[model samples]
Target: MPKLARTIRFDESDAQVFSRPAEAGEWAIPGGFEFSNWTEGDLSGKARQAFANGWLSLESFGRATLVAVAQVEEAELEPLARRLADHFVQLYGAPDAEAALPIAREEIAYMVELCADHSPNVLLAVSRELTEAGVRESFRAITPAEAEIDLVAIHGSAD
Candidate 1:
């Protein structure tokens, strides 16, 4: 699994950095971060829906690692991508500064471009550490391959 870290800037004074395990589809949010009410199952359900609708791509399904290297606002994202974006904002807070590295800036730019595509096949994974609540929430937009696996797991048949 490939790993990448990026700082998400919500504003000039608030920001949070996150690292993700891309292949495993998990986010490691450090303790002390807080966000609105959300559950792992809720995120999973959304991801499943995205997969069923063919919104997430195979290459990005569980492979793309995104680290918040810059601050992004809900206003900055397209309508469809807002749910996840807002979730991040509510949880980690918005980004506060420009990306620290050229690659990070490029990645953020890429994400912005992808969000504009509005394709259901594009997957997004987000997570946070809520140590105070004694819970950690992770979510992702599911991929076609994962949807097939889920189908097989449920029906016990490829058909």
Candidate 2:
């Protein structure tokens, strides 16, 4: 099984900060293509927040601040690739999906490789910026603490 990144949200801030916040649990990719034509002036307000730390959601085509590593079935790849290709044609103005398919596959593959070494449930965040050379991106991994319950967990008892 290949590992993949999925969006995760701990609070409402993602909704407040991003122009379009990705739904929780949506599949994600680095999505640097969105910023390929951007310059420093484009980095302002929510756009700046997105550039600083956002992963692109595959389903909503929205932005996420963090993603969790998850296992992916091999069968899911082709459909996802097709969806990405369609998105390229529709949004990025690719001549056609056939012409965009290869690039979509490569982008998905890159995200799969990025998650492969990390265990499931590990969180990943990305930071991006444009410099004189070009767009630059960096990533960081955060491992969840080893605990059976989180701070907001609930308990139930029955008689």
Best by lDDT: 2
TM-score of each predicted structure versus truth:
0.22, 0.90
For candidate 1, what is the TM-score?
0.22
Who wins the TM-score comparison?
2
lDDT of 1 by residue, 35-112 (tens): 234444443533322222211111222212222222335453333233334444444455522222332334434555
Residue-level lDDT for 141 in candidate 1: 47
Clashes of 1: 21
The models' CA-based lDDT, in order, is: 0.33, 0.90
Task: Encode model 2's per-residue lDDT on 59-126: one tens digit a residue.
Answer: 99999998999999999988888999999999999999999999999999999999999999998989
- After superposing candidate 2, which stretches have Cα over 4 Å from the reference? 146-159
TM-score of 2: 0.90
In candidate 2, how many Å is residue 115 off? Answer: 0.4
